[model samples]
Target chain A: MKVLVADDEPQIRRALKVGLERHGYKVVEAADGEEALDVFAEQSPNVVILDLAMPRLDGLGVCRELRGWSQVPIIILSVRGRDDDKIGALDLGADDYLTKPFSIEELLARMRAVLRRVEAGQASEPTAVTVGELTIDFARRTVTRGGTELHLTPLEFDILRYLALNPDRVLTHRQLLTRVWGDEYAEDSHTLRVHISNLRAKIEPDPMRPRYLRTEPRVGYRFLSGRS
Target chain B: MPTTRCVYSYAVALAGVAAMTAALAALESVRHIANDSMLYLLVVIGVAVRYGSGPSVAASIASFLAFDWFFVQPHHGFTVSDPAEWLALVLFLCTAITVGQLTAMLRSRAEEAGQREMEAAALAEASWSVASQLDLDHALRVVLDRVVQISGAGDATLLGEKAGAHQVLAQVGDALDPAEHGLLVLPLGAGERIGYLVLRLPPGRELSMAERRAVNSLALHAGVVLERDRLMRVEAQTQALHEADRLKTALLSMVSHDFRSPLAAIKASAGSLMAPGEPLDEDTQSELLSGIITAVDRLNRMVENVLALSRLEAGAWRPMVEPTPVEEVVASALEPLSAESSARVEVSLEPGLGEVPVDPVQMAQVLYNLVENALRYSPPRAPVEVRAWRGYGSFVFEVADRGPGLPLGSETHLFEPFWRGPGLGESARAGVGLGLALCRGLVEAHGGEITALRRQGGGTVFRVELRREVGR
Candidate 1:
């Protein structure tokens, strides 16, 4: 996979390039937003990570222009963790949003998640994912626990499918809201929590002390198979 | 039609004639002609001093005619008895007229002196009034009012450039119609037409010498005051710009120091781990990896906090407040801190506590700062307590820690940026002191209040009060 990292800070670009290259992906670096667009046209990377604040043609402007011609996965790197900046970037057709000072590991996980969704959508072929006692059949659109059928509401099924497909990776509340409930519900984390709690109650042996579905504190939810 | 004083002077002249005739008749036995003539001269001089030049001159002429008819020889006839009497009459008329003219001149000089003194005093008063007013707007108004009053004009106004356009600054009496009426525009400042004082005097009426002097002096005073006002405004603008520049520099330095330190550490550690020659032990590798993680974590927190502070400073943070449960927000804020610090705090919220109207994310930041501050200050073993309840129609959240209490009288300065308490050393107070200041900004932006106070028994208590109802 080819990834483009655009940031004004030399150290951030250097670090991202080293880390992404070490992970066996071809990496291209841009020092500014204008350069980022030029590199995107020339290199045609599979994914792009953009820093929101840049000299000339900031991340939002680039995201907007790039979305007009291409549907490439774009992840916004913002120092501002406020919901407004995230929503603005997402509304402008960014695929994901990550706050700054994030580790290479977290960035890699986010990029993988976004790439998987894009690839899966393009392939259109469904697959089943099994983690611990829970089995999610994407073709049948059903979830079962330990060979026994477990009925779930459609919303709950969608949430479980998203979580099971990206197991062991953390998802932000905004990311899940945009994916599951649509873009208009991007600012509401309360609804997401309620749905997640309802889903956990039906699946987990003890809802109070969940073993498979885990909350990453203020961030979001992650599904652990509990095998590790 | 004669003036009343002129008629009175004529009567006095006739009276003098009658009195002299009666005196001559009574003193017919001993008559000295020169002495009797001197009595008529006394009447002319008295009238000249009493009445003014016009009445005095009339008295002098009348006395001359009466003396020619009655005192001179050949009184019953139309001719003088002798040419010598003609000379005596001419001398007497000249003496009376000259004496009347001198007396009139002396009276006018005294009156002019008094009038000049009054004008000077008025000018002094105007200067004092203008000088005393420090406020530019009020000073301009007072100056316009004085200009109109002293000049006896129908009205007065001041015009100056404000915000790149010429507009009326102050006016008194009727609103000035510059197009309709003639105006006396006195330009303020050195020849540059920075401002103008305009007066509208009635047609056919002009300022007298004294009034003119007073008006001119008042205009000068007004000009000085207007110039002072302009300078003051420029000074204020320059000061504001200077402050903004200073803040930008401070922010730049702060960002450079805070961001680079952690990046350097993380970079060094990451480089060492990935170095080819480092075939290090497992323990050393894990330690290096963990070090990189910690540095990254610190960088993340600092980055997030600084961004939040900048947004708040820029007045760009518009929170979307809703009725939210306080416990959920607190739990979310505490989630990331609990495991890392190993200082778990369980807040016992009051049952049936009403929902607080707040922005969920910002409120989380507020709670996070308070909780993290509590954790940082207290001993690792001491439990941090969070208590919540509704009081006085507002939701209150208190974070109390069993740490050394804040220095006395630091409550006021506690929420100020870069303010660290006296007891904490450099290492103890990690992270820039933006946590509490950011908390205060976010809280206030939400129409809530945050305060730090010394706890009753020991330690410090941070209390945040959120209004029950949300307002836009």
Candidate 2:
């Protein structure tokens, strides 16, 4: 994955470039707002990391400029961890943001998430399906293992269908609740986890070490298919 | 020679009187040989004109003797032969004396009246000096000057009471030590002195009566001016205090409103985020973070604006003005926010535009705030324009965007603190608006003005104008 980091402070730019590149993404750097624009135009990076403060241009200005022509996923790095800024950036078309002094692990995770969403939009076919110790029929919603039938609840079926629909994509707990249980249940991570545990118990050969459903710590859960 | 000349003039007068008496005696001798009245009446009129009232009585008695000897009955014998002639002689002498004295008194009274008229004219001309000057200080100076001219004192100073102590207010010529110039204090009570008069220590024994009266009059007039001036000052101070009180009330309400809105948003957003699940997808998690950052940015700008106000009051910060480039300024202000917003920012500096004279750091701050303000208002899908151009000998940097135009009347009040417009309050993602106020301060520090204009079709434009630094 290609990522762009825009920051006026060389230290922050250098640090983010090192951290993001260490996560196996190709990194391009801009020292100031002017260079950030030039670099963005040249590189067409898959993901852009920006600082709110910069010399030639600010992160907000850069965000605004990029949003005009492109719907590319953008992540803002802000020291100001206020709701207004988040809303401002999101409303302006930024994909996500990371406040300064963030853990490198979190940055890598967000980077992964945005790329997955971008990649998901262009994906064409449903790849594969598996249940218990058997292959499944995706079009007809049936699963068998060892030549025996497996019973799945209607709610469980719906959850499996969503997971399969967004295979290898990290879905935050809130996203999962909203998509599956509706908007009112978006905040109920406990409910989401219980449902996920139940789904794993029914579908996984070893529920403790699930192969399909992966837990992304401190952020969300992801569904990784056999292709990975 | 002096004795002969005195005698000759008196002798000439005596000769004319004696001749008149002889002629009257001849006429009376023809008409009535015993009448002496005509001769006596002639002598009385002559004495009134010649000697005045006191000397005139002596002249009248002498004339009576002349008449008895020359013009009475039994001429040239000093006796009137008839009893009727003797009675006439005595009556004529008494009437002559009284008439002479009355005529002399009237002439002298007319002369005394003329002298009094001259004194009134001199006094009127002197007091004219006081009436012409209106300023209290000027008037007092004129009064003192007139006193010096009128009373012939060599020098003058007007001393006034301020807070119950005397201070020399206005002086003309050889300013005197309070102790040196023999001062006459007349404190203006209902009937007392509230002021003092100083006069030159004239090389003389003591003050004349006229000098004392002139000093007393000056003190009375000065007290009127001093009291009037004091009253006017008190009234001015009261008016200023009332205006300050009004401003304070306005400030308090605005501060309350400004602080409450963003704080509410922050609290509400935090409350929402506290729930266990990420209600918004991975994308929405990012959205929530962006909102929080925006709110915090608003709060920071507000705090900076308030701090700037306090600093202005205490004179803690004074701008060190110099020439600065617009492009550089834009970069410095935006550098931090670009990363924070995660948005693309566009910056274009007008070519051939000269540097503006301003404090470099403050100019940067001004640019930062305007860009930030525009960013908050504009859509993230739109490119925020930070454009600098030269117009009419002034350099202007404008942060323009395709956002909702400023609310009615808000274009003018936009730079006022806490002025969240209808456009801002309408936004679910709005912030407390102190950014514009801080921009105003930074611009004004460089002797320029900042204005927010609603663009013709759509969008808000913040225009900052600065005078170009000369010869650069």
Candidate 2 yields a Cα-based lDDT of: 0.66
Model 1 scores what on Cα lDDT? 0.75
The C-alpha RMSD in Å for every predicted model, in order, reads: 11.9, 26.8
Which ranges in model 1 have alpha carbons more than 4 Å from their true place?
A8-10, A31-35, A41-43, A81-86, A122-228, B1-157, B161-181, B186-194, B199-279, B303-328, B335-343, B404-413, B428-432, B444-447, B453-459, B469-472
lDDT of 1 by residue, B64-145 (tens): 7766666577875547979887887788878888988888788767766876786787667766776787877787776677
The digit string of per-residue lDDT tens for model 1 on A117-228 reads 7877676545997777878899898888888888899999988888777665556777889899999998788788767766876887654345567765445677774432
Cα lDDT computed for each candidate against the true fold: 0.75, 0.66
| Chain A TM-score, prediction 2 | 0.59
Tell me the lDDT of model 1 at A88. Answer: 68
Per-residue lDDT of A209 in model 1: 42
Error of 1 at A98 (Å): 1.3
